[model samples]
Target: MSRILLVYTGGTIGMIKNPETGALTAFNFDELLSNIPELRLLEHKISTVSFEEPVDSSDMDISDYIKLAELIEVHFEDYDGFVVLHGSDTMSYTASAISFMFENLKKPIIFTGSQLPIGDLRTDAKENLITSIQLAGLKERGKTVIREVGLYFEYKLYRANRTTKINAEHFEAFESSNFPPIAESGVNLKINHEKLIKPNLRKKMLVHKSLNDDIMVLKLFPGLSQQTLSYLFKMPHIKGVILETFGSGNAKTDDWFVSLLESLIERGVYIVNVTQCVGGAVHMGKYATSERLKRLGVISGGDMTTEAAVAKMMYLLDKNLGPKVFKTIFETSLRGEMN
Candidate 1:
């Protein structure tokens, strides 16, 4: 039987509604089996490890991210696969960071959570949690079917770095518009082998815990004053910027805007151009507006979600790859984050 580890870092999936107060509160995860007895029927040996104090997704920081990565690193060899219970709000960010932190990953790291508390009558937690565990343990011909970080919700399993939280009030809270799901959980679990990341079982997993969070996301919009934009970019601490541009990465071609970005690039602030639209890539030079950004050494985040861009920026900034190499590496798909 496959040995699976359910790492509970706290989220809506672990909460139960109090009968008296009607407030949702975290329950002891040790009684997970009691809460979800269907796990007993699965043929996998499941174990769990939870944070000492549950962290709200909104408050998850770099330290918490490192802690999660270290936990998986410590027990990576002991388990066949891992299922992470994370908050739906920042699950994509955390999962995408984990994907970039691990190298040569040969087993599944499936993240899943629910929109409602686990004890609620109409909770989506049970199916998400149960199926995530099953997917974690799924293998064929003595090899794990999934060999990279994935986020499973509703019925689809998407590559972690390709996902974004699109809905705040729906059961289907996450979507991957840039890429298709690697698997789908229907009557029979369907694995899309064509999309799965090939694994190298001969190599040991390499964990990268060093991350630099000194980055800013500057989303461009009309009526954004030049003085405000200039001041934000001039902040000495920001090492990188994710420039959220209009459709197809178009930005204002005003001399002031272009000059400010050019100055930042010269001053060693790595800038990446990503589209604000949900389902399109950043074709930097396709338009006259973005052509100047391309000329000024701005990297293109082709079809990459902003969550992935942020995580990748933090991960790469720590390496001190300088402006040239950093731009090249950021534009490259090291973890299949960009096309």
Candidate 2:
């Protein structure tokens, strides 16, 4: 039997409606198997752990992320896989951070949660939890099929760093425009081997706990003032910026805008150009507007989601790389976050 660790960091999946107040509240993980007895049928050795205090996904921070990595590190050898319960609101961010946290991962770390409280009659939690556990425990020929961090929702498994929560009300809250689903759940669990990341099992896993949250995302829009742009780039501790530009990474070619970017780049502020479109890669020099940005040493976040871009920026900034090397590494795919 496969041993799986169900790490409940708290989210809608662990909520139960209050009979008197109608407010949803967190329940203990010890009651999980009893609440959903169908889990027993899977016949896997399941172990669970929960945070001391439940936190809403919106309240999650870097400390919570570090705790999660520490938990996995402590229990790394005891479990075959891990299933993380997180809020859909910040699931992509957490998952993206975790993807960069662990190096040479050899087992699955599948994140899942629900839109409604698990105790609700029409809750999507049960299936998500069950399938996530099953996916975690899956192995073929004594080798695990999934060897990376992933987010599973609405019957589809996506690369965690590639995902973005696109909806606030729908069950299908996450989307990976730059990448395809690594696996799907239907009549039978279908694993797309070609899309899944293959890791070298021989390398020992190293967990990165220090994440510099000094980066910011500056999304460009028409009529945005030079004063606002200047203030953002000139912020004291801001180390990097995710420049979300027009389609295909185009931005205004005004002299002021170009000068501000040039000054920031010279000041050692790493800038990455990403597309605002849901489904396209950033080709820096494709248009006249974006060509100048490439000449100014702006890095291209090729087909990367903003969530992943933010996490990657934080991860790389913590390393304190030189300007030239940092630009090269930022454009490269460290954890399959970008193309």
Error of 2 at 338 (Å): 1.7
Candidate 2 per-residue lDDT, tens place, 1-339, comes to 789999989889999999899998887789888988989899689999998987788999889999999998999999999999998999999999999999889899999999988999999999999999999999999778899999999999999999999998888999998899999999999999998888877888889999999888888999999998888887888889899999999999999999999999888899999889999999989999999999999999999999999888888898979999998998899889987
List clash counts for every candidate, in order.
0, 0
lDDT of each: 0.92, 0.92
User: Which run of 10 residues does model 2 get worst, by summed lDDT?
Assistant: 230-239
TM-score of each: 0.98, 0.98
> What is the Cα-based TM-score of model 2?
0.98
Q: Model 2, which residues run further than 4 Å from truth?
A: none
Candidate 1 local lDDT, 1-339, one digit each (tens): 899999999889989999999998997788989988999999999999998998988889889899999999999989999999999999999999999999889889999999999999999999999899999999899878899999999999999999999999999999999899999999999999998898677888789999999889988999989989888987998888999999999999999989999889888888998989999899988989999999999999999999999999989998968778888888899888888
Q: Once model 1 is optimally superposed onto the true structure by TM-score, how far is the C-alpha of residue 326 displaced, in angstroms?
A: 1.1
What would the C-alpha RMSD of candidate 2 be, to one decimal place? 0.9
